[model samples]
Target: MNTRWMARSALAFVCCMAANAWADRPATQTERQAMGFDDPAQLVMVRDLPFPADSDTRAPDGAGLGDEWQTRIGTAFQGRTGAFNFGGQAPSIACTSGTERFATATFDLPAGAAIKYVDMFAYDNSSSEEMLVFLLSVCQGTGGADPPVSTILANSTTSGTPGDTVVTLNLSSAPVIVDRYTCRYMVRVNMASPGGTCVGGSIFLDKVRMQYTP
Candidate 1:
């Protein structure tokens, strides 16, 4: 395996370990059941928004990402298949420079579905600097600028390779019950602070999965 793959694998292992540890919690198990979550059928009501395979194709249906509503497909790397940069340039880019560049994608869930968990699988190209945040709601207002952000799924610094960091949020603490036409799940990435080395400066988004029950 290549170095990139090795790094990504190690990161994935760490995430799994963390998830396993969380699974061992009694409160977590009860919450999981209350939300209708099972490892095998966890995604029964999930709605996914994956990056396009390349520039030739368009982002799936309502899925999109960019700083200014631009859909820039990230350049695929050696082992990071189907991975795209959420903010900054692919391969690598100069320091963020403190302007707060970002990449956001939104997914609409079924009407009247109850969301249980929100998970995003992505990472920073460079070291641990970039951050990931989520905003989920039932009735997102009309078109134009981004919606009002309230729920934050993950607000910690990146800690792995460019495509293997998994950020999972348990909505059990604050159950999100959709009563409107549909529930919108949004993933927002805040680029790392500028002035760092060039190699680890971008955020790579691989996939997003939502667990819900209608």
Candidate 2:
């Protein structure tokens, strides 16, 4: 074999191996820039709120307006979707008066981190079932403006037939800024319907997940 040909072949082999190694490994910032690729920022799952089976407010027990809704099993104002059962906004307090029917869950968010969005897994079994998710501050407001900020993360009005047609409500566009030292935010799920229409079929909240960016 010619020495020049052998040297050229060896150089090509070494280059091929180096290219394969680079492709196998995660892309570095410089490599991505060279390829004209901007690695997309991945959403980080910061919190997951699932319905507790042994929840006290599952059925007979009632979750009155402005009540702590940690347990979510047999609570008042609930409906079943064959696949899963969830709490609904029955005995709605929002229409009744200043009070509102909501289930509150607190989650720890790191200080200075901003909320990207929230995912609410639920199904609307009835027409015009209004589901509202809000992110509230945990402490008093520095300027005394409502003490805490109540930002609406997600809101959906169901308009489909009653069935197991579950869907995910994405509150991606609404990003709430987290700047509290406590690093805690309260999530409230307010499920209800039009005035004077508290029926059995309401929006059922099955699960909730949130993402944030530091």
lDDT (0 to 1) per candidate: 0.42, 0.42
RMSD of 1: 18.4
Candidate 1: residue 58 Cα off by (Å): 33
How displaced is residue 147 in candidate 2, in Å?
4.3
Lowest-sum lDDT 10-residue window in model 1: 72-81
What are the per-residue Cα lDDT tens digits for candidate 2 across 29-79? 533222212324421122222222353322233322332222222132222
Model 2 compared with the native: what TM-score? 0.42
**Candidate 2: pairs in clash:** 57-75, 58-73, 58-74, 58-75, 59-74, 59-75, 141-147
Error of 1 at 76 (Å): 14
Q: All candidates' TM-scores? A: 0.42, 0.42
